[model samples]
Target chain A: MEEQVLIAGFGGQGVLSLGKILCFAGMKKDYNVSWLPSYGPEVRGGTANCQVIVSDQEIASPMFEASTAMLIFNEPSLHKFEEWARPGSAILLNASLIASPLTRQDVRAYYVPASELAEQAGSLQCLNIVMLGAYVAACHTVDEETVQAVLTETFGAKGEAVLQMNLRALDLGKTYIQTQK
Target chain B: MAKILMKGAEAIAEAAIEAGCQAYFGYPITPQNEVPEYFAKRMPKLGRTFLQAESELASINMVYGAASAGVRVMTSSSSPGIALMQEGISYLAASRLPCVIANFMRGGPGLGGIQPSQADYFQATRGGGNGDYYLVVYAPATLQEMCDLTKEAFDVAEQYRLPVMILADGTLGQMMEPVELGNYVPRTKADMTWAATGFQGGKPRSIINSLYIQPEELEERCLAMFDTYREIQAHEIRVEEFHVEGAQLIVGAYGTMARIVKSVIMQLDQAGGPKVGLVRPITLWPFPQEAFAKAAAQESVQAVLSVEMSMGQMVEDIRLAVNGRKPVSFFGRTGGMIPTAKEVREQILALCNGGKE
Candidate 1:
């Protein structure tokens, strides 16, 4: 039950936000989880990332030896983490991201047109959701229901519409992955 | 008691609030910025004093002013910032002001990258700021220890009329885990008495300056401070020993890196005393020197391995603590390239086999 997830992309692509969401969602689901971000200059408009781990046992170190799955919102991340993935590891690539599909196929690779799908969903801001949906599909550590409950709790009193839209994006992702499978 | 996951920097800020700290002076630095942020958002709402100074120099001086006013005060920074605060730190040491300073160490010499590093070992245990006074320094590897030790640092500061430090790394600051928020019994504001509250009728005016006219008097004061330091070393040397009995190797570590070493000890034990042991120095300043020395004296101990985010800072102390009685070895991954327990085990095994490493 040791699931290591990496979310990587450009700085403003909500990489930090997505990682936090998943880390917190795991906590809500009562799992031992941790979120470690790339600190220092690795954050300003350049490559940014965070490692989120959910395990039934105590996390020895907040680092991952083999990232079980990744949500790459850009080409660099795809190229960077692709070499490190183990067999059967998932690489959910956003075709609309900075990088396209040049990744080698020794693992489960999915081409998620997440950016365009997000724009069509009436909110480009929800691209993170599309990628997160891929993560959910690949990892299945937490259900969509749990994610929604966390969103409702996180969005506070004024988050009703946000909660709905985010859920929509998530479902859109589920449908997108479902067709591929 | 309850449980919650807390970062070392966040715990320092929260502990400041609980310790009745009237002011928190600080500047932004990696791995340690959470302390200021936590205070910035919460202190104002709580009606406590909070200031984000322009530089570490300004922050430390602000701490000086706040402390002089007979109020609980705190400031935190990384190695560079601590270097900037050295002058003021020396003054605080000399004046015997009670305050807490947290060092979220990153790799360094100059403008080091933002990652966990214990390279400040010499600077910390030996007094980086300079002067003869000793600070009661605490090195917490866990979030729980960070919070608990922070509050305890304040108490030690006031009790001994000295400065205390929470020496942690960025890993402890940016990581999240389940932590217990148990029954928090904050120390009462009235519990501490050596403050600079203005003198009342008939009460003599209290001075908090570090100036003394007589050289002999100053010397006496210095001697007394050393005596206090020795007493603290004797009474407060805390260490967490793991898998030591009948163990072949002992890895000495502290702070965030120590947790990884803890995991390594478990792995070694499972690998048949790959018979490895651990000595966690929770108090980096006082250091668990006596414990390690005693352990090293045993023939089965073989060699001591020092693991840290720095190249090899704490290793020097380990060697000295062992006093050449045992062969001390070092292995590290700095610049944020921390190694796993397996790597450490490989290094230790190489050493014990008398092979090139």
Candidate 2:
């Protein structure tokens, strides 16, 4: 299977890190993965994005014009990438920040209240983790156990409170999508 | 060891360390800053030298100094920064110093944007520096190839006592992939009888200088270097070929552009379009002329296309290599604009249909 995923948000919103986590988890599952970030002149409030490809076959090019799936966190991202979404693609957006409805009828859209869920789980920093959970649930791109393993290994050094908060955020996102379906 | 995810720049730095790079000196530039940043954190911990030079000039000169002392040294920069170091690079070449230089190129004739580009092809393949010299240049397309070639670059430099270059772009530098780094066995330095270490009682003092007072002496040095260059050209040309045995069109590209062209070839194949092939040059300086010549000699091959991120720099080499065996065409995007797969596919189809794109 081949999954070309694009993640876009503000520079400080962990857009790049979210892509990195997915690639790392994909690697653990023996999938060929690549991550290419938009390293433009982006500041804290500026736009940021990354392209990720996880496939069973070797990836030829990391940059793609169309995405099989997209995780958009802001209105700017939604406006920018809506056209690049391929038909039958999945778009997971942040409902807390993007109030505009998706205009494309060819793709599937999942609206996750990532910011609200992060705050409810105790920190706004884990909003990316919430989106990750929703993406995993909606697309089945990776397994939940592999993601949890990655999170535990990545955040285990930060202390139990931070680790627990992100874990709770992941569950909240997953449950939200599952209940909606 | 198992594979781990690493950015291309960081992976190159680690590969250098694994290949026993003893010193690093470089100034920061966009699209390649991670190279120096990686060295800054890891070099000191490993009891090696990592200095952020005041400028690109100082960085290359420092490299010359360390290489003269028989230490494996490296430095990295982007397009404009590399231009600033041309003089020092020439000096290093003339002195026969073994060192590695990496150019994670960006758009430029001057200080251009910090995006991926192959505009520096002439600057890299032809001597960007002054004097009659050549650097063994490798253009790697993937992160895994980047690491493998980086490790091999140091060995090639030391083997020939000539400078070597890793010519990659910002996209390859910034991208991440799973790569299996080789075991970290520090390389043992070979016996360098000409290194400028402390003089022995009976031996002559080793002098490292590029200048020669007499014209005859300079000519002799140039002739000797050319002999080494001829040996390298004979034995070191590398290329990758795909479905070139009996194809109508053969696409030629290197580095990032190669990856894109390969994808387009696959897409065309899946769609049952014209039969296409690719010849990706791994060694840019050696040019892989033989590979192109042989591929073009096939009776089924009609035309050749050179794809690049610049406005047809490498196409000149392709034409010279083909030597009228097939009509060579060019397709490119410039100023940090990467060509998409659709664009490349269209170009290929146009070429196959006997039309200019």
Candidate 3:
């Protein structure tokens, strides 16, 4: 289906990690995937972004302007991606920071307070996991179970403290969207 | 064969692993640092020597040390670092030591930027190191080809007793893709009969250096080396074509830029795909002349579009290949900005109809 996802935000906000997580998960699900990141003078404490392509066939080009989905973590991200999104694409926004309302009615828009939910769930860096959760829920490209397994494989060996908080983050994120959030 | 997703740098390292290379030497540089880092982790496990030298010069010298010992060895770097190693490469060439080097080139003239570029074309093909020498150059677009050709590079280096290189750009070094590692071909130090490991049996100490005071003898050596290069040009040319049959425009690009141009081909296809064609040169040196020249003369092809990262490095080669029967046009984006297929197709359409897309 030629699916493309772009995750963008401030450098410290974990946008690159989110893109990597999504790409890694999609790859494990038997899809052709590529993850490209922008890091340098342009992203020096400023805006950092990554483009992830997950396709059912060989991805022809890694660079695509109008992607099918975007997980925006901050204000700059929304400004960057909002213009380029296609007609029926999905825009997932982190409402805690992006105070503006999504004015476009052509695409499906969801505002999830990712940072607030992560903080409420007792971890700050879990914002990326929460966004991943909302993305999985919105896209359904990879099952939640496979994501948890791959997440462990990618991040589990670090330590018990990280393992514990990330697990909680994942669980809270999945449940929040499925129920109240 | 085991299929694993790897970055171009990592894939080159894995390819070295499968080839059973004796030692890998390198210093960290952007775009190609991952190759050395990857080798550091894996070489120890395989019992091969991996040295992170103090500088590119030291790394190339270390390659000299290992190659003189007649065990497969290699060093990798980007343009600036490769420039630092030029003297070492010249020494290796003069002494006739066989090894492979990887040049994952970034933008340059000085410390330009960390963007992919083909600016190193003249340096690579023209033997930037010294007098009358050519390192059989291999350029890879796909991660699989990087791995596959690394093995071939080692073989060719040893078989002809000269250096080999896999010339890539920042995109080829940093980008990740699926790659299949080929069957392991184990190499051991015992395989080299003429290696200088402190002369067992005391059969006259072998000296390896590039110094030749005798002018006539030096001329003979130069002729001998050229003979080897001629054989390489005759037998080692490799290239690929895309939708080239019966097309009005021919686009020539290499490495990562070629991959991007393919997308432009598909985009053109979607817009009723341009009656345009592409020639992707897998080898920048031993320049693939036959295929390009044969295609140029066909009445089907009206003009040749030379698309490259730099202003006009490959364009010169295209002009040389066509021999000026048809006008070869250039469309390039430099300092690491990749050209989109749409952008290139627009150029092709412009020349095709006497107007721009």
Candidate 4:
């Protein structure tokens, strides 16, 4: 299956990192993957975005005009990308920062207080990880087990305690979706 | 070796190292600064020479110096920076110094923008500097191809004693992809007779200079260089064809635009659109004129579309290659704007429907 995802937020919000991790996770599973960022002139606190494609076959174009999934972390990201969503696509909305509700009826929308949930579970810096967990739980783009393994491998060098906290943040996000279900 | 995920810039840097390029000199430019950043940290560890020159001119000249000393040396830049290096590039070409030069092209006639563009097609394939010179230009469609071609570039330059250029755009330089870096057979440059490595009681002496004031002597030198160019054209033309068997419409694209055009072709194929195909020129300089001629002369081909990221630069070569065998058209997006696959497919569909776009 080919999965094209767009993740967008403020520059310091770890949006690019979220996309990078997903790319690494997809690659670890031997899938063809590409991560393309919207760079140049973007600064801290400015809008940051990236497109990640994971496919079983060769990925022809990494730049996606429309995406199968989107993670909207702020209002500007939602306003910018909501109309570009393909039909039946999933949009994971971070309710903590975005006050307005998603009005798109064609695509599925999952609302999670990502920053609040991450703060409660560990730290607000893990906000992206929380949303990533919720998105993975909602749609099985990549296996949650594989994501966990990737996270462990990625964060292992920091320290055991830091890794556990981030893992807990991801689990909290997954549990948040399960409770809603 | 297992495949590792790497950005195109880093991959190019590592690939050069793998190819035994012992010297790198460059000045930083946006969308490709990572190349120098990578080499600065890695080259020291590898016991190679890495210098961040004060200017692009200085950087290219430094490469000239190292390459004249018979070491595999390279330099990279974006469009404006590359413009500054044109004098040095011409000198290297005239002096028959083998070196690799990479241009991660951004939008330009002059610092147009820091995004991707193929506007430099004319500058790359044609000589950016004055006089008649040709750099064997390789346009990679994917990051893996970029790495592979970069490794092969060193050998091609050495074998031909000519400058080889990896003419990539900002998109390919910035994107990340999984790359399988296989082992490269190391090339030793110890016994190069033409190299200016000091007359160590060997032969007599070697001189590397591009200035021959005598008109007749300069004409002879240029004719000799043209001989090398002719040999390269005869032997080293590379193109990748897709679905060209009975295609009515043939799309000729290169670099990032080729990848996007391929996507459009795939969609058209799936939706039972016209019999379309693509002819991707992997080597832009040795323009693959013969392949274009064959495809355009096919009984089924009615039109040839040349898509680029410029206001139609490479289309001229396409027209020449087609030689009026079929109608050649141009499609492009300039000033750092990338055309979508859907838009290209729509254009193709319009053409299929006999509507001019």
Candidate 5:
């Protein structure tokens, strides 16, 4: 199965790193994956988005016409990428930041209060990771084990405390998704 | 072996280091700044030299100096920055220095937006620097190919004794994908007999100069360079063909644009509309005319479409290669805008309808 995901938020919301972590998770599973970040002026303080494609086959263009899944962390990201979702695609939104509901009826969407959950879990910086947890739980693109392994690999240098906090943040998001359904 | 996920820019940097390139000199430029950043963090650790030159000119000249001393050296920049280094590039070409230059091209004309663009086609394939010279240009379509070609680039540069260029737009430089990193075998530079090390003992002094004031002597040097270019053209032409069997139309593209075309070809294959194929030129300078000719020679092939990210820069070469055997048409998106697969397919379908311009 192929999943084209767009993870979007403001510049400092860890959008790019979340996409990279997703790519690493997919790679650990031996899937063909690509992560393309919006570089240049758009990434300064404005809405920054990254397109992540994970497939069993070769990924052609990193930029997809319509994404299979989207994780929006803020209102701007929702407005920017909501229309680009493919029919029946899954869109996970941060309900804490985005007050609007989905307009499109064709796709499945989950309102995961990612920012509030991450903030409660310890820090608001793990907001993207929380959204990533929701997407992974919904799509099952990669196993939670794979995500945790990559998280350890990525955050290992930051020491045990930071790594455990982020891991807890992920589990908190995953638990929230499970409770919702 | 398992592959590792890497960004395109960082992959190129790693590939260069793995190829035993010892020195990197470049100014920071958008869309390609990661190249120097990667080297800056890694090269010092590896004991290799990494210098962020004050400007592109100084960078290229530093590359020239390191290369003249028989060290594997490289410098990378985007469009406007590369334009600044053209004079130094010309001198490097004239002096027969072996070095690699990576151009992660962005939108062009002058100081255009820092987005992906293949608009530097002419500036890259045809010498931007004055006089008779050619940079052996390699345009990689995938990040894997980007790493592989970069490793091969250093070898080709030293073998041909000329400056080689990796002609990538910002798309290839910024994107991340799976890359099977190649092993690094330490390069021994013992065979650099002509390098300007020193004239110790009774050894004769070696002079490296591009300036020959006498017209005839300069012409002679150019003719000799042309001989090398001809040899390179004969042996170094590389192209990748996809779905060419019984194809009624051929889509010609390079770099990231070629990947987009490949997706279009896959779409047509699934729809079973027309027999379509792609001819991806890996080596742009040695323009694979033979491959184009062979693809055009297919009995079912009706026309060839040259798809680029520039305003018909490579179409001229496509027309020359097709040589009126088939109607050669052009489709492109300029100024860092990339044409989607759907839009490109529409163009291809229109071309197949009547094989018109």
Candidate 6:
């Protein structure tokens, strides 16, 4: 199986870290993975994006024009990448920030209130993690336990309180998607 | 060692350390800053030298100094910064210093955008420095290859006592992938007898200088270096071939562009389009001339295409390699613009249908 995901948002919105964690999880599952970030001036408070490829076979190119899935966190990101989504692909957008609806009709779109979900879960910082949980639930690219393990490894140093907060955010997202279905 | 996720720049630095890099002297440059950053953090902990030189000029000269002492040394920069070090690079080559220089190239004939680009093709392979000299240039397409070739670059540089370059771009430098950073086997400096270690009583002092006052002596020195270059060309030509047999079109690219072309080939093959092959030059210099000549000679191959991130730099080399055996065409995106797979596929399809442009 192969999945190419493009994640885009504002600079401080954890867009790059979200992609990194996704790739790390892919690596843990014995899959080949690559992450390419958009660097330079554009990443400083401007829109930031990263392309990630996770495949069962060796990946040829880290950058591609189209993606099988996209996680857009802002309106600009939605506008920038909506056309690049492949037919029958999945798009998970942050409903809290991106009020405009998706333009493409060939793909599946998931409107997750990531910021609101994170706010409800205790902090707005876990919005990206909330989107990750939504992506896992909707696309099933990876398992929840694997993501949890990654979160533990990533946030474990910050102590149990922060870890629990992130865990709750993940569950909130996943449960939101589950209840929707 | 198990594979771990690493950025291309960071992985290269780690690989250099594993290959026994004793000193790192470099100035910060975009698309390649992480290289020195990684070295700065890790070098001191390992009791190695990591100096952030004032400029690219100082960095390369520092590299020359450390290398003359028979230590594994390296420096990295982007296109503009590399341009500033051309004089020192030439001197290092003339003095026969073994050092590794990595160019994570970005767009430029000048201070261009900080994006992935292979525009430094000519500057690297043809020598940006004055005089006739060659650097063993490796253009790696993947992070794994980046690490492996980085480790090998040091050995190759030491073996020939010439500078070696790892020609990469910002995409590869910034990208992250799983890599196995092989074991750290300390490189032996025993063979570096020519190093300027210090004078000993009754022993000839080793001198490291690029100057030869007499024209005849300079000519002799250059000819001797050419002999080493010829030896390197004979032994160290690396190329990878994919679906070359009975293919109608063959695309030639290197580094990041090569990977993108590979993806295009795979897509076309899956869709039952015209049979396309790839001839990727792992070593940019010692430019796999024979491989292209052989690929162009195939009866099924009608034309050759050179894909790059530059306007058309590597195309000249491809044409020289093909030598009228096939109609060679060029397609590229310059100034930090990366060509997509769709665009490459369209180029190949146009070639297949229109037959030679």
What number of backbone clashes does candidate 4 have, counting pairs of residues 3 or more apart or in separate chains?
0
Candidate 6 chain B least-lDDT 10 residues: B182-191
Q: Best by DockQ, which number?
A: 6
Candidate with the larger DockQ of 3 and 4:
4
| TM of chain B, each | 0.94, 0.97, 0.95, 0.98, 0.96, 0.97
- The alpha-carbon lDDT assigned to residue B172 of candidate 2 equals 87
For model 4 chain A, give the 10-residue run with minimal summed lDDT: A57-66
Regions of model 3 farther than 4 Å from truth: A41-46, A102-105, A156-168, A171-181, B182-191, B202-205
Candidate 2 residues B17-52, lDDT tens each?
A: 999899999999999899999999999999999999
Error of 4 at B316 (Å): 0.4
Query: What DockQ does every candidate get?
Result: 0.48, 0.87, 0.48, 0.81, 0.78, 0.91
> All candidates' TM-scores?
0.92, 0.98, 0.92, 0.98, 0.96, 0.98
The local distance difference test score of model 2 is 0.93
Off by over 4 Å in 5: B184-191, B355-357
- As a whole number from 0 to 100, the lDDT of residue B123 in candidate 3 is 86
Ranked by TM-score, the better of candidates 3 and 4 is 4
Better of 2 and 5 by lDDT: 2
Share of true Cα-Cα contacts across chains kept by each model? 0.47, 0.84, 0.32, 0.68, 0.76, 0.92
Candidate 2, after superposition: displacement of residue B177 in Å? Answer: 0.8
Better of 2 and 4 by DockQ: 2
Residues B55-99, candidate 4: write the lDDT tens digits: 999999998999888999999999999999999999999999989
Q: Answer with 5 or 6, whichever has the higher TM-score.
A: 6
Considering chain A alone, report the TM-score of candidate 3 relative to the true chain A.
0.92
| Quality class of the docking in candidate 1, CAPRI style | acceptable
Candidate 4 per-residue lDDT, tens place, A1-181, comes to 8899999999999999999999989988889999999989999999999999999988998888788999999999999999889899999999999999887899988999999999987789999999999988998989899999999998999999889988988998889998999
Candidate 3 clashing pairs, residues 3+ apart or interchain: B264-B341, B268-B273, B269-B273, B350-B355
